[model samples]
Target: MSGTIHSVSERFDFTGDELAPAYRAAVDAIEAGDLVVMPTDTVYGIAADAFKADAVQRLMDAKGRGRDMPPPVLISVVESLDALATDVPDAGRKLCEEFWPGPLTVICHAQSSLMWDLGETQGTVALRVPDHENTRELLSRTGPLAVSAANTSGKPAALDVYEAEEQLGESVAVYLDGDRVSGGQPSTIVDITGETPRVLRVGALSLDQLRAVAPDLTSDDDPAPDPTDAPEPKPTEDAEPTPTDAAEPKPADAAEPKPADAAEPKPADAEPKPAEDAEPTHEVKPTEEPAEASNKGENNKPDPDVRPAD
Candidate 1:
């Protein structure tokens, strides 16, 4: 609420391609720690300084989100990845090198102390460096912005500045109105949290597209076992066949089933007896005496009870 929603959407339009005032106003808004709705190559995103805890919390509350589900950090450029994430697994780092300035979000271990939360962060963070000018400009002035698709939690992402303004104007303080984002889709999200990088949500990028970078990525149920680690399959051999008319009878001295037999025989000396261990340990007894023991009354009143009955 500290800044105004200045009209810069027209400047961001790719058809018109004018972008001077839009960048300036958006930067000003971000510098003041205000939220901004802006265009990216992917979709319209509402952004706030990634490090400003209060502003970030306000963004989450406004969007009806909790700390457990946080927004992603949008950096101005790819080099910013190291600043926000630690231990960028090789697979994720490789993805960043190829997909940054494009529609792809790399999930990695967030710095232990990052104050902002993206939606359902799960002790991790989504990082992106979009291929858009207005977003880049705003990010440069604002530092990293914890942003998400400019739509309500479960709704479609806004594709243009005007639509974003219509949808998020009340929630965000500024809209860095730029060109209508192409693809009109969210970036592909891959979680590199485990031994293998996995596609949590597929988007603009196809599985084949991701494989070009991380050969280890797989949409298959199981990762292909490492060539060096896999045990070789056992060799199959023919077993000796019995003569058609000859059959082996059960051994008279055998006391247990043979490995290939269907039935197991008991020992000859073993006797069958009642299974005493299986007997019921507890018994129920009626406390009342038989009917013959009770005295008859002429009125036939309800039987005199000795003990209270449930």
Candidate 2:
């Protein structure tokens, strides 16, 4: 019934000690089967008591999400992982030891004995220990809470309380305004229900960082080819140009008639003259140039001296 927003910044000055009143209001709201929007290390989240089925359903309905996409359970301590999840492998344990209380979500087999439903989870539960002190303290008081990003299913997650209010206004019963989240990136989620741990999503924690702890940790997007190491692909038949299309271009039929003109002395299909025939014509022109001087003593007959010169 207490659908009100409390500002931790204005009242508590972000002091962890002064946040008790706001935490109490959130806890009361959850116990009454209502949704509460609170700030986490990553982003603002709308949380409901995991054991309260109606509250969880309201949380899902407010976010426009379905049962197939179940929200994760947030714990105050790492030991709570056993209460919610089972079959925790060594690699999973190592990763939890290294990255717990931060942006890391591990999905494991749910404990069968627990009498609660979180939608169609398929016997698996996603768990996380958020790094924020205020959120963790609230978790310590309220136990495990089914939490999801405060936004419509397809919309961007809210970064602050005001954004959460704008997206999920009346649906949430209590709003804990802790200002904006420091870590903008979502948690890195890993599913350890199988023989090998496979990364379902990459977020704040990188593959390399996870590998440093669990060398065998694998992902569906593993072994990305290094851009520097990848060799440039050789052109194929489809992409490569042929010789005719390359540097040597095909000449047009009428581009230049010089080749045909050079071979034949006349235009069109006329045959070329023999070398001997061309030589006499050139020689007679030179003799005609001295015709005036020779006219006084010589007739139109061949000179006897020219016979040797012929």
Candidate 3:
């Protein structure tokens, strides 16, 4: 029961009641700002107190991840969505209603009032309500946890408790073996922070399945309109008319110095060229490969479609 980091992790079988000693040990470890490996809906995850800055940093460090790849928060219930995130759009709510307690991770703008840090979240947080009952039961007591797949950054996600232990080692204080539940596929991820919901990575849920709930949902595969093809034509049509009209008035208003007024602004107009040159430097959303499952377990298989939350 020591809160200090354990040099050797202890594993316990979490079955039967939620109030078991194993659950208590896991809870105590989390509250003490220590890392705990627990079974999530998709994959076993290393969890830390989401509100604790040092604990969260330990999670990132254990996974060999930097601040850029912030771990997703696992909540106990749907109601906790509003408590962590702000401006949950109607589309986001509908998606959550249809797919929560399952494998759909939604990234929304984080609540500004909250003091916790989940790393370079860029004012947003990825949230999910896992479908596992025991996990949810533990979450009800622990509030929210900053969880990521229980493995090193480049390794495959751990499907069972032993796999988690092998990779995480003593960095974790406690391991709650929920014994690998069904649906091993990673959760499908959708980002609802923008005006429309876009699939960052497809996993347990399909793109078609998401669109059924939010018809406007788009995937990374969908081609973004070529910037070169769009505004250029409209500007061409508008610009041609203006010059023709300017020509007609040139004879009568030649003495008005209108051309001088117009030509004087050319340098100011050229200033935007650098901005136009800089626009293409931006890249699209990061694409994640499906997590490869370990061969040590027969039930564990490599998923080809969706990237894991880790």
Best of the candidates, lDDT: 3
Q: Between candidates 1 and 2, name the one with more favorable lDDT.
A: 2
Task: Please write out the lDDT profile of model 1 over residues 203-242, one tens digit for every residue.
Answer: 8888888989899896644468776675544322321122
Quote model 2's TM-score.
0.69
On residues 89-122, what C-alpha lDDT tens digit does candidate 3 reach at each position?
Answer: 8988999999988999999999999999999999
Q: What is the full ranking by lDDT, best candidate first?
A: 3, 2, 1
Instruction: Report clash pairs, candidate 3.
Output: none
The estimated TM-scores of all candidates read 0.63, 0.69, 0.70
Q: lDDT of each structure? A: 0.66, 0.78, 0.80
For model 1, the superposed segments whose C-alpha errors exceed 4 Å read 1-18, 113-120, 220-310
- Using TM-score, rank the candidates from best to worst: 3, 2, 1
Considering only N, C-alpha and C atoms within 3 Å, which residue pairs clash in candidate 2? none
